[model samples]
Target: MTLAVCGAVSACADTSNTPASQRGFFGGIGAAVSGSDERRAAGLEQSATDAERKKQQLEARLGAANADAARTQVQVQAAEQRLAAVRSDLQRQKERLAALRAGSPSGSSAEEAARLQKELDALERERRAAQDASTAVTTATLRNLEERTRAIGVALDRLGAV
Candidate 1:
């Protein structure tokens, strides 16, 4: 009977087996770990999303600045071309006026004097308008460049790049 009892007790002490109830605790720990890992993953994903949004906004502003620069260049070129044409026209007008003054009497007739004066005044006005246009184009370009430079500088400062 003692020998039989010893064999039965050895059989009950199986080294490779665990109770089923303790498995629940390990499962709960695994679930908690998974939940914490999911929270960390979500946080990382949100950070990446925010970074991407900022990059897109910067790109959009940069593109707008480049486009504005191109438009300003075109406008400045057009203004320059118009100024050249106006200069040529002014030269011809001056020559005509000089010829008219030369041919007229020393004490000119009232009507002749008035007509000549009117022509001169019209030419002067047109020249001034052309000059004004040229100045405006130059000023506009400079201001636009300055604004863009300042904006970029501020952005760089925010990024600690400057």
Candidate 2:
């Protein structure tokens, strides 16, 4: 009776720690076992770590892009202010020239007026060019920032899914 009990107890004992090849067909004494579960857990951990690292990198990129956009905006504002100042100066010069013309007409008055008009025209052209250049630069900067923002957003979304 003792021998039969021991045999039955040993047969019913758990063998999850034993290699599948070594365990008999009756290895179902306990829950199923394999290295796959542990490997899968480790793989999941690695994937999660990679996702976190990617998310952090994307966030850094987004921060840098935002800073650049802010700096570019400041530069654009300064340029616009400079253009406004130039336009104001041009207007003042025109008013002063008109006052001088109204006060007198002399032998050289026609020539002097022509020269002043040409100078005013040149100044206007210069102001227009500067304004256009500033606008172009601002546009390019905004476009670059927008593209970077979109790319970063996509990367963040992928990280979230992961």
Candidate 3:
């Protein structure tokens, strides 16, 4: 009887140091046979979770960054178009000035010639002012777009998803 009792006790005894609660959870391994294995498993699981969460966050931020980049691109294109228009207007003014110079009356009164010359100078000055204003606006618009693009790129870098 004593031999039978000892056999049963030895058979029921737990050999490994792993805790019972950390084992047989839904009949699957929770902890591990070795303590280091348990710790490594925990670290790996945590790292995987952290990586997944970061990926989701980066995806959300990327959408916003892409939208900002698109908006900036549109602004840049519009600024370029306005600049082109201003340049075209300047070209037209040059053509008009050339035509005026070529068709001046040969023998107008001295006073009349002086008045025509003054009119031409005033028109040229006005056209130049308009051209300058357009250029300034276009430059400002392009700068704004460039700043926005830089902000988007910074965001992308910060996310580290790129």
Candidate 4:
């Protein structure tokens, strides 16, 4: 009878049939064996680090783009000013040529008129050249500004997503 009772008690106490979590007092050994918590922590840490690195790279790119845009804007303004000054000078040269033509009917006056005409022609050519250069500079500045704007937008979107 005692042998039968001992066999029943041993069978009831056998923890091999139970899960590891249920076998331990606090399931500490089971957590160590799975290591899920530690892995999750490591994954989270790596994600944070990657996010920070990406943000820094974006910031640097944005700064550079902004600086480039500013410089291009300044160049465009300078080109416009130069074009305006050339146009003003051309107008003054035309008025001077007209005045010379109206002065008198003498050989010396005629020679002066011809000289003024040549100067007027040169001024017109300079004005046209300045206008063309201004147009090219403005176009380039606009293109650069648009590209930088697009890059900034993309960076902002990425930052939001992160």
Best by lDDT: 2
Please provide, for model 3 over 1-162, each residue's C-alpha lDDT reduced to its tens digit, 9 standing for 90 to 100: 966654554444432454455545421232222244466568779999999999999999999999989977886566657555544544554454455445553444334434444544554454355445543445655444344434433432332221
Q: What TM-score goes with each of the models?
A: 0.52, 0.59, 0.42, 0.53
**Model with the higher lDDT, candidate 2 or 4:** 2
C-alpha-based local distance difference test score of model 2? 0.61
Model 4 CA lDDT for position 81: 78
| Per-residue C-alpha lDDT of model 2 across residues 1-162, encoded as one tens digit per residue | 966654564557456355556666545332233343356568779999999999999999999999999988898897777667666766766665676667664556646655665766665776677678885545454344334434433433333333
User: Candidate 3, residue 146: CA error in Å?
Assistant: 20
Q: Which has the better lDDT: candidate 1, or candidate 4?
A: 4
Q: Which of the predicted structures, 1 or 2, would earn the higher TM-score when compared with the native?
A: 2
Q: What is the C-alpha lDDT of each candidate?
A: 0.54, 0.61, 0.51, 0.58
* Descending-lDDT candidate ranking: 2, 4, 1, 3
Tens digit of lDDT per residue, candidate 1, span 51-123? 9999999999999999999988888787777556555654554565455555553443435545545654664
The segments of candidate 4 whose C-alpha lies over 4 angstroms from its true place after superposition are 1-31, 104-135, 138-162
Candidate 4 steric clashes: 0
Model 2 ranges off by over 4 Å = 1-33, 105-112, 137-162
Worst 10 residues of 1 by lDDT: 153-162
User: Number of clashing residue pairs in every model?
Assistant: 0, 0, 0, 0
Candidate 4 lDDT tens digits, 1-162: 866654554444444335555655434343444454466568779999999999999999999999999988888787777566556655654664565456553565566556556655754665566567664655554344334434433433333333
Instruction: Give the Å error, residue 135, model 1.
Output: 5.6
